[model samples]
Structures are given as structure tokens and as C-alpha cells.
Target chain A: MPYSVVGIGTSWGGLAAMRKLLSDLPADFSLPVVVVQHRGKDSDQLLTELLQDATDLTVCEVEDKDPLMPGRVHVAPANYHILIEAGHLSLTIEEPVRFSRPSIDVMLSSAADTYGKGAIGVVLTGANEDGARGLADIVKLGGRALVQDPRTAEIPIMPDAAVKAVPSAEVLPLEALAPRLVALSHEREKAGARRAV
Target chain B: MAVPVAAVPSTGAEPDRQSFKPDLERIEIELLLEGIFRHYGFDFRAYAYASIRRRLWKRIEEEGLSSVSALQERVLHDPEMMEKLLLDLSINVTSMFRDPGFYQTFREHVVPLLRTYPFIRLWHAGCSTGEEVYSMAILLREEGLYDRSRIYATDINEVVLQRAKAGIFPLERMQEYTDNYMRAGGKRSFSEYYTAKYGGALFDQSLTKNVVFSQHNLVTDRSFSEFNVILCRNVLIYFDKTLQSKVHGLFYDSLAMFGVLGLGSKETLRFMAHEECYQQIAPPEKIFRKVR
Candidate 1:
């Protein structure tokens, strides 16, 4: 709650991109991170278990009416949307977006509604441009937005679209993302104070 | 940020537009939103472009333009056209007593918490033309809480803000609004609240005595006031989810402790970091009270 709420969207090769961000944040550091990785509907394998192994931050699949906590990462589950309202979180099997559940755009826009500048959007290696405009909204509300360097990304379309939609975003390579994440987390704490002012 | 007109062939050629040329179109929107922000200060750089694209393309089709690039040129030259486009793109379609159940539920479910507060500041975010503001005012009046409340009715579009200020609505729409008003628990006939003029009904200004209509954008703007209740409905669906959370943060910051947050029926506490901060006052209708 004190640090930034980062929303990352990656389609094809997203998990690796997020792992790069997770490995960088210190254990004591407190930022709530939410991610929307396009999930296939019929796949039974749990994404949280998969992502938890990749990050030091506790990765958990979101549930209905779950409270968003600091120092934890929430991933949208398959066949549902992740929404933040009045500070509590909700996961709904409401509708599909752009042909996928756990839509990057749905999570991103809802987060933009909730966090404003407290939200930070990161677009990782992915094939589609689902989160580009939503990430642009993050920047519009004075939140930080980052795109992984497309050239180095295993799948670049997602990051490339984000860069194209949001021209002012910070573009960094995968290796550089972790330290920047830490710095951004700190900057957000200050902004939150300013916001409360 | 203007592109060469030469790159777009002059008007009078085939109306070669089913959709935009993908590559050129993609970059143009980024530039266009930037140009608007820099020149006009109405920041739309963050809206879900897919939605904006659909809206703008509708404008392009109506005006018989070839490309979004072509539409951009006209938008730069014609402020009136831009205003119309702003209305089309930004000022949402609103009806009186929209989600009448939301209001009914607010009276039963949320008003008790409201009654506990002393003087209250309610922010009607995205109060398109003030229909909901009047609706809320009427509700508060019925509950004997009207004098204790001040409603800030805000929207990104100033044109609609003026309409909201006027408190007038098309007379033709009254029949439907009356039904909605009844659903929202209006004790008196809705016609008693407005006077007919200019083929429209100018709603009674008394309902808006405690209201302030202003210009504010959820996309490119910051929080302006601390409020006891923040009502933003049907607006977030146009945004991608990330933008939705940022807007939520602004609302969260703008809310006082134990303030109420009302979202559209479809929108709710999901995926946002502050989900624990509010308790549901009306779960099915999506009205929530900020707990944290």
C-alpha cells in the first residue's frame, strides 16, 4: 500500500519478463504488484504456482473480494477479470476481452481508475498490444509506465505497441528493469505522500 | 506534430476507408493525443485507444474522411469540430435515473452511513450533463439530507458541463426519465421538478442549489477535492484496466476516511491494490464505502 502498484501485461513470453522485475525488489520492500498474462481458458495448470517460483515476491492468483496487500503480487486468474474498487479487489468471470480471460486491458484500466499515479504499468515481452493504451492511461494520470526494450524481448509486439501508444514512457532493457523498479517504488511512496497532501 | 498533408492524398479520391492503415494509424494516435495535451491541455493520452479509435473512426465516417490522419488535420483547424468530437468521444451517453436500482439501493443501503456524517461533500465524477446529480439531489431531498450535502458535478468536457449547469433536458426524454425517477423512488411526479421552454424542460434549479459543476478529466487530471462520496459510473469501461486503477487511486486519494465509492454495476473491487480499503454498501449495484 505504501509503494507502487505495478501492472504488467505480457502475452507470449511474459513470465520471464516479470521474473526480471521480481528478482530486483528487496524482501523488505513493499509494493503491490498485479499482472495480467493472457491465459488460455481450458488450461488447468495454475499460473500463480508457476509465477511464484519465478519471483521472490509472493505471487498468488487473485480471488473474489480479496484485499490487495503490499509486498505481494496478484495475478489475474483464467476466465476472470481483476478489478480494484474502494481499495478491495474483486475477481469476476464477467466477460472476455480481446479473446482472452485475465485481460491485460481490463486489469490495466481498472487499476488506472483505482491507483492513478500510484499505479505503475510495465509492458513485457508479448506478441499483442493489449496493454498499450491502458499503460498510456497510467502515464496520463501521472503514474510511471515502462516498456521492455523490444529488440531484446523474446516477443516484442506488446512492448512495441506500448511504446507506440505511450510515447513518453521509460523504455529499458530487461537487465535494467529491476533497479528501475526499486527506484520507481521509492518515488511512488513520495508521490503518495504528496497525493495525501 | 502535424504530418505532411501531401502524404494523405487530397479529398475527392475514392473513399478508401474501411479502417485505418495499421502502421501509419498507430503512430498517428500517439502524436495526436500528445498534440492535444500540449496545445489544449485536455490530456487524453491515456484512454483506451481501442475505444477512442472506435469513437474517432465513427466521427471520421460521419464527416466522410479517409483516414484518422485526415481527421487529425480537420481537428487541428476547427475548434467547433473538436468540441463536437469531444462530446462524441468524452461526454458519455447518460440517462436520468440510469441504474435506478443503484439509486434505490443507495437510499436503502448507503444513506444510513451518509446520515451519520455531518456536512457531506459528494463528487459526481463524470457527471455527464448532470442527470445523476439531480437524481442524487432528489434522493437526498427525500431523505431530509439535502441541506447537509454539497455535490460537485464534474466532467472532462466543458461543453457538457455547461449543459449540466443549465439543468435542462430534452422534453422528449422526460417520459423515460419519469419512469426512471419513479424507479429511483421519487415521491412526486418528475414533471413537478422542471419547467418547459425551448422545446426542452429546464429542470428546477433548486435541486442543484448544493451542486457545483466543473471540468475534470479522469485520464489526464489529478484529484481536486476530498469527498465523502465519489460516484464515477460507466466511465471506466472505456479505459483499459491499468488506466482504470489509476483513476481508482485518484478517487481513493480524493475520498475521506469511510467515504463511499460508487461504481457502475459492472465495475467492482477486483485486481486493484486498494480492494481492502472499501466495504460493499450495495454489492449487486457496486456501491462501496471506503474503510481504509
Candidate 2:
């Protein structure tokens, strides 16, 4: 099935990783990418501006009910939990889970629940294990789970935990992740075209 | 409104059952909401669909139920279940001096405007548990306007409204609140406003002396009074576009000329019908003054 959304979660050392991954994706990349990166509650819009400079695709900090559209990267605002809906995003100030607002587990679980087999969950480098359960949820719902190989991660604890939670997840190096996503985006389209003949 | 358990029609030969399930789930949710509205006086039929759906599923999983329809049956028949569900839906996450920058902006820009008036009437709509209301009271007190200002703090849930009236908060959060206070340009030590009692930080009862705490449903209720300032931060985010427009109209009608309005940091008056009527006062702060 064609994936509808890509939910990414990261924490410490995430900025560099996210910059690399997002910078690599082409301008016309078909899937809508939503990211949850743990940051200080008072952090400014520097992240969005920096990402916008790095990628050709439009990058924005999500508001209350922003639509999930292609050719855009949506970053969760600080101090709110971002939940995935059918074709849009909703935010809540619900108390943080595991002492983390903008919790990866909450976002990924919502994506899994909403998109089912059409969701793609990616867990990158981080010091905490916030995204493991979320990645597991995505896998349980027949969605794809991708984790950075611990050996290639800036901080391996997060990816290590995710690997433990969902061993069947595709583990790629830091440099390989963006390419894999690009290939996945086109794989379905290529298949559809083939069947049409 | 009594929907049978087997109301979800079985899809026969759909090639994409995955896609069909969400549509069926949407129908089940609608029926459940309609039943809740008919059985209970509370109306949530116009809430933001995505947020409400997430909250419903949270309650469903907590109760060990599989579907919205199952939860709806219990909610309609059992008053206790409805109370729990109501709390889940209405309890908003808030903090004292949340988005301190917004409060700072209010002090700098809105305070001067308030000084020109003889008396200030402020409304804190959807004041969850009273943190922001207390925060406002303290700000006014520091500003030397507390004597003439009356705050009407209202919420849809009576449970939270009572808590807001009590003026007690978890002591563990005092440190964070103090930091927020300092950032919001508080003039005095934050600890001076509250005493440690009742297993929490009990705020000075005098803070709420001029404040009226009451239960008011923004969704179904009409505006009760005109005000100089209307603070409905983050409350409209729970509403869909149609409901949001309706509430905006209510606020517009309720505010006197040149009244100030404050919203959550991420919220905007961009597409509302009254967008042109209000001029944004603080750049990027979502504070607006009724101009037209």
C-alpha cells in the first residue's frame, strides 16, 4: 500500500540528523513528513528556519489544525503533543508522557492508529527511548518502521531501544535513511504504472 | 439515538478494507456523539473532529472497550461513566504564566490600555483549574489595578471551575511557576502570593476576592456580559472552523470598543470573519485590539 505519512522522532543530537535527512529529500517528495524533536519549552523558531534553509520543500511549525500536505515538513511546536488525524494534524496540551512533551510515542501511535498500513515511522538518534513504543505501534498496525542503526547513530540509546522494541524494523545508517524513504515513495507508483500495462 | 451494536455495515467485496474501516469508524463516532448530546445536556457535537476522536479512543482504551459505540452506551446509561468521559474531553493542559512572553506582552501593551479606563472587566473563558486566572490576578495586583478590576473566570466543567475557585496548585510546580513569573515581568517574589498548605501551594484567597468563578459552556451558552478584555487562550483550538467562527462572533459582540483579546501563542485571527475588525497589537503574540 502507498504510504500516506511519515512520522519522525528524535531527541538529543537530532538537529544534525534531521538536517541531513530533510536536506536530502527531493523537492517533489510525495509523502508528508511530520517530525517531533524534543526541545526546550521556550525554544524559538530557529529550527524551522534552519530546516527551511536546508531543504527545498516547505518547512513549517505546526499550528492547531494544519493540514497534512505533500511537499511540506511539519515540525511539532514546543510544549504540545502533536497527534495525526485522517488528513490533518491536531495538537493537545495533554500532560507530557515520560516527562516529555511533544512525545514521539504519542505522535507515532496516533499516526499508526490513523494511517494503519499507510504510515511510515522513523526513529533517529537520541539519548532517550521515547520513540520505541511508537515505532512498535506502527509495526503492529502493518505500517513500516525504520530505525537508524545504533552503530551509525550520534547517540545510540534511542535507536538501540527502538531496535529492541521492533527487531523487524529496517535499520539503516544515518546517510542511507533519506534515500530509502525516496525509494519507498516511488516504489508504489512504479508498481501501479506496471500493473496498468 | 439508540444505535444498535451491529450498525456498522459489513463491507462485502471492497478491495481496500483498510481505507473503508476509518469511514465506518467516523460514522460510529458521529452516532456516539449524537447519543451523548441527546442523553446529556452537554453539547460537543461541534468540537474539532481529530482532537475529540483521539480523546474518545483514550477513554475507550482506559475502559477496556473496543469501539466508540461501546463507550457511548456506557456513557449514556451510566452517569458516572459520563463524568469520567467529560473530564477526559474538557480537561485542558495549562500552566501558570504559560507562554511567559505572551504575558510579558500583555503587561507592556495591554496594561497601558487598561490604565486609560476607570474600571477593567476581564473575562477568562475556559479558565481550566484557574492557573491563568490567578496569574492574571497577581499581574493586576502588581500593576496597581487589582482594586478596580473584576475577573470573571468561567469553564464548561464544574469540577475544574471549583478547583479554580479554590486557588490551590501542586507545590511541585511552584519552581516552574516562579521561573515563569519572573519571565512575565513579575515585580515581587512569586512565593509571597501563596502559602504551602493542603498538600499544595494555596494562593492568597484575596487574589480571587473580586473574581467571580462560575460554570459557563461556550459551545451552547450565550455571552452574559460586555467586557474590556476577553482572554480565551487555547480554548478555540478544541473547536472546529464553524464553531470557532461562532465563538468569534460571540466574543466580538461581547467586547466593548477598543477591547483587547488574547489567544494562545499558536492561535491566530487570520481567517475569522472579524479578522479585519481587530488590529494585532503585539507582533507575533496573537494579542489583538478591536479597531473597527
Best by TM-score: 2
Report, in order, each candidate's fnat.
0.00, 0.16
> What's the TM for model 2?
0.92
lDDT of 1 by residue, B47-147 (tens): 65545665677789999997877878888788887887787778356778876788889989878888998898999998987888888998898899999
Best candidate (score: DockQ): 2
Residue B50 of model 2: what lDDT?
62
Provide the TM-score for each candidate, comma-separated.
Answer: 0.57, 0.92
Docking quality category of candidate 2 according to DockQ thresholds? acceptable
lDDT of 2 by residue, B55-89 (tens): 89999999999998899889989999999999999
lDDT of 2 by residue, A55-111 (tens): 988899998767677657999999888888766677778879898999999999888
Q: What is the interface root-mean-square deviation of candidate 2?
A: 10.4
